[model samples]
Each structure stands twice: as structure tokens, then as C-alpha cells.
Target: MKISILTSLLILLSLAAQTSPVLKIKFDDIESGNIFLINVQKELTDTLSINNGKVTYEAKIAAPTFFYLIVDGYNNTRPLELVLSSQLTEMKFESYKVVGENTVNEAYPNSPIFISDPNNNIAFFEFLSHWKSFYNTIQALSENDSEEQLEKRKNTYHTFLSTNKQIIENNSDQYVSAKMIDFLLNNNLLQFETLQTYYDLLSPKVKESYLGFKIGEKSGKAGQLQPGKPAPEIALVDIQGKKYSLQSLKGKNVILHFWSSSCAPCIKEAPDLLKLQQGNTENLVVINFSLDTDNSKWKKGIERAGIEEMINVCDLQGYNSVTAKSYDVTFIPVYYLIDANGNISLKGTLSQITEKIKEDMP
Candidate 1:
């Protein structure tokens, strides 16, 4: 009887150890709504129903992973980003308010107050706060062109970099270190060399994390793209499922525009792009390479922009698309001008591309 009881206790302990992590969220100001949890690594979204301003969610994550939480019908509120590990995590939102009198309502306090953070979320938030302070200071200094202000800005910038480097190094083993590196790189906040140094400081286990691998992959491929280098071959299907390739468009100057439907800047420049294409229809082929994953949105964006004349194509892989990786497309609205010889001639923003076209094509 004693042996049987001991065996049963062992089994129960094993089962408890294998249980998935749970996320508990409490919003004092919100009630009877749905909270969407987006798992960044898995690219999956789960809806958690709020009952009495509280909800509990279970996540099947083995390591520290990034998640975004957004309230339904709250388009104005930025998604709350947090890192979750294989442990119980809790968040609390004390206050919120609906803004604007329009049909669409915006919400405030997108970030949540941590009730219990077993992971490195607290550290990540601290880092974000520091970065934001530094960013605002630099922006304010930019408005003052005095020599003293300029020197102050330079010193402040270097100080920010040094402080961030120290923070990352101190938390090298934490998952938040990798998250900080990713945030800095994605926002173009840090120089490539500094980013590489920070990346190298990550612990072996953190380096093997999902975000870490993605950063390394992007950095490794960054040097492959430049002027005079052969443009990477792009073989992707258009909206109509017709296959297209850069090889097929040889002997013509190609403007490879990387964009996405959700990107406001890309949409804003649509009419200008259409005009450019219309004016130079003889020898120029403008290919709109979209990074949107949703098929309906991609088509709707094209229709709304009235740029059907341009070669609109998408692999529907978003940032994970092979073509985007080859071109080192970190952000959207990136324009690449490839010459008739199939070599990259220039790459820049829309205005710069326009200048290049006017100088070379005219």
C-alpha cells in the first residue's frame, strides 16, 4: 500500500510538470469583451473571452516567446507586447479610455501593468522606457541647431548607445536581451556594428531562441545586397497565380518596389508610383512586390490604389518571404532600381528613386 501511494504521487508530479503555461489577464476598466493574443513566433492568434474583466489563457510555448495583446474594436490602441515563458504570467490594466467621436474608437494605455512576470518582461519594459527617453531627448535636441545643442545631441547619442550596450550585456542570458536587440534593429536605432556586437553578447541558449535566429539570419544576409551586385532572382506568383521572375523581365529597367497593404507609407505613394509607371511605359517595368499575407487584403489594396497596370505580385509570406530576405527588406516602401543588365543600379526611398529615374531615364 505504501509503495502504491508513492508511485501515484510521482505520477501526479510528472503530470504537473508537463502542464502548459497559463497567462492570466485582469482589466479593471474593461468588461465583457474579447482580448486577442497574438503569438509572434508561431504566427497564431487566439481569442480569450473576458468575463467580469478577467481572463485566463494557456500557451504552448517551450521557451520565452513574444506575444501581442489587443482588445477587440480597439483599433487605436497599440498592441501590448510581452514576453512569455513556460511559467505563469499575469497582467493588469487599471485604466483605459475611448477617444475620438468617430465611428471607430481608439483606446489608450496599450501597455499593461505587470501583476506577475515570471519571464524577462519587466526587464524588457525597463529597456523600452530608457530607449524612449533617449529618443525623445534626441528629437528635442534636433530642433535646436545651436552649436551647443549639436554637441549635446552627439554626446547624448553616444551615451544612449553605451548605456544600452551595458544593459544588454548585463542581461545577456535573459530572453529580453534578444528582444531589445530585435527592437533596436527593426527601428534602425542602432548601427550595424553595434547591433552585431550586442547580438554576439547573447547567451548560447538565447542565441538559439526564435528572435535571435531571425536577427542573425537577417544580419548574415545584409551584406549580400548593394549597388553593382546582381539582383537576386525573384520567382513569385502574382495575385492571379501567374508565376513571374526577374529573369523574364530582362532587357528592361525594373523598379522593384517592396511594400505591404497595411503599410500606410506604401499606400500613400501609390498614386505617385502609378504616374511614374504611366509616364515611362516603354522601357520601365515597375514590379510591386507585396509582403502581405492575406490574399483578400492584397487584392483590395491594389484595387484601392488603382495600380493594376504595375506588375503586382506577392508570395503571401510577409516578412518570412524568400524574396524579401534576399533583398534585405526590413521595412516596407523600399524601392530598388535594377538596370537592363540585371544588376542593381540603385536603391532608396520613393523620392530618391524618382530622382534616379529622371536623371537616368530622361
Candidate 2:
């Protein structure tokens, strides 16, 4: 009877262990204060206060999740945005002063050397560390006239990229790998020709992640619709709530311009765009896709820019707008010129558009 009781107790403890996974955070020098764990998807914030420089939270983590560890410091500067993942069980770091909005000094006093969990999180930090080291080496050799130094720097960069590529390829199934790709893309560290190579290395499961899907969408659309390719269809509603499709403007030379009201370059090019429209009214049609969420802001930008003559459409979904995704419009103030046959003739900056138009028109 005692044996049966013991077996049942062991089973219950095992089940409980399987159900609850604890996230433990330790900051050696941090004062006893409040910290927050914010669910990136749900936007739910769970507050916990430090007790003797440590805190722990337990949850039933069935699947992986991305979270933000927000530390509001005593100095009253910007909050630290430390990204956390469900894969990590414990995190150890030291409180650092904010030097800039997105910068933190890791060399703060009493800060112990730390490393990410090797189970799932280390690849990202490894890539970042190597990249930063390579950058510093290049900077140190910038004024050095020695050919050997330049050659050594080149070899070091090549090796760094190769190692990171292998790391990404090895962890292709993890969401962290996809996040690393996003990091590289935002920093312009990954070359355009190499996008497809890294994308192909990703597992289908990782590709389905939010960041992975964006990378996949970009890779699928990159080098496509360059010249003579049929332009991808864009179906969206204008600010007036009327439906318009990219195919509808087939007969005219269509300029599909992607922009946002907040983009400085887009705003700066307003006069030049107006001039472009005025010069080619009969032969051209400029359709602007505004990746703006707020209807009021889109309306005000249109009014302020005096671009009433152009076809203005806004799905109001910002970066995730269907029209923007269809064109892979990652950067703003991008324009694509489609010929009369609904085929793309050029896709680039405003100046490139001007040059391409001049080259083709004459």
C-alpha cells in the first residue's frame, strides 16, 4: 500500500514538472525594483519585482514564444529591451546604463561575463559577436597601408560570414535563426545575392514564422519583375473606398510607388513626383500605395503633398499591408515602372525611374 502511494506521488510530481517550466532572471547588481515580461504576440505584461537581485516566474509553456524583458532603470533613461524566448530557462545579466535609445554599455562595472543558452539561443549572439569583432578589426586597419593587414581583414570577414552561415544552416528549424535573418536584413549585413541562399537553408517550420515568412516573401520576390516580367497583381482600395487593381491600369505606362507618410524621402520626393506626373499626363498613370495604418494621417499626407492627381490607396496595414507584401516593398519611396503590356520595365529609386523612363521613352 505504501509502494502504491509512493508511485502515485512520483507520477504526479513528474506531470507537474512536465507542465510547469520556470523562467528565472538574475541581475547581480540590480536594485530591488519592478520588471516586466511582455508577450510579443498577446501584448500582455506580467510584472515582477526583484528580490535580492533575482526573480523567477513559472508558466505552462506548450510552444515557443517571444517575450520582451523591459527593465525601467533608476536613472530615468530609455527602458532596456531584452528579448527573451521560451527556450531559455535561466538568464543572468547585469544592469547597464543606456548610452543611446537603442544602445547599452555591456562593459558596466561588476558585470559578469555571460553567454546565451546553447540549446537554442546562442547562434544569434555568436553571429553578432563575430560581426562586431570583424568591424573593429577593419576599423583598426583602415589607415594601415600594409597590404598584409588588408588581406588579413578580408580573410577574417570571409571566415566570419562562413561560420555564421553554417550556424544559421545548422539551426534552420529554430525561430531564433529567423530572427537573426531579420537582424541581418535590417542592418544591411546580408547581401542581396545571398538572400536566397540563406532562405533555402531555412526549414519549412521556421519559414512559417512571422520573421521567416517575411524573409521567404522577400526571397520569392527578389530578382523577379525586374524587366519584361509580368507585374504582380495588387488589389487594394483607395482612400475613397473604391476598388483598384494593378491589372486595371494595363494600357498605360504605370508607376506603382510605395511610400508612407512618415518616410522623409517619400515626402521629399513629392515635388519631383508631381513634376513627373505633370510632364507625362497622357502616357502615364502613377498609383501610390500608402503603407499607413491611420486613415486620418493618410488623408492629411495626401492633402499636404498636393498629390490629388495620383491614384492613392492605403490598405492601412503598414508593413504587413497585402499590397506592400505583394511587391516586397520593404523600403519606402520605391517605385516600379510597368509598361503598357502590364510588364515591369524598371523598379528602383526615383532617380533610377527618371533615368529608365528617359532611356525607354526616347
By TM-score, the best candidate is 1
Candidate 2, residue 201: how far the Cα is off, in Å:
1.1
Tens-place lDDT digits, model 1, residues 1-362: 25698899999888766756479988887888987889988899988899999898875577888888777876334666778887889888787554333522222334568878877587777777777777778778878568798778878878887888888888888888888888877774554445557778989888888888876654442344567789899887766677777788889999999887766568889999999999999989888998889989998889877887678998888878998878876766778899988988777677878898899889
Error of 1 at 78 (Å): 0.8
In model 2, which runs have C-alpha deviations exceeding 4 angstroms? Answer: 1-19, 74-88, 94-99, 102-119, 134-160, 221-249, 252-326, 331-362
Give the Cα lDDT of each candidate.
0.78, 0.70
Q: List the residue pairs that clash in candidate 2.
A: none
Candidate 1 is scored at a TM of 0.56
Best by lDDT: 1
Worst 10 residues of 2 by lDDT: 103-112
- Candidate 2 Cα deviation (angstroms), residue 309: 24
The TM-score measured for candidate 2 stands at 0.52
Whole-structure CA lDDT of model 1 = 0.78
TM-score for all predictions?
A: 0.56, 0.52
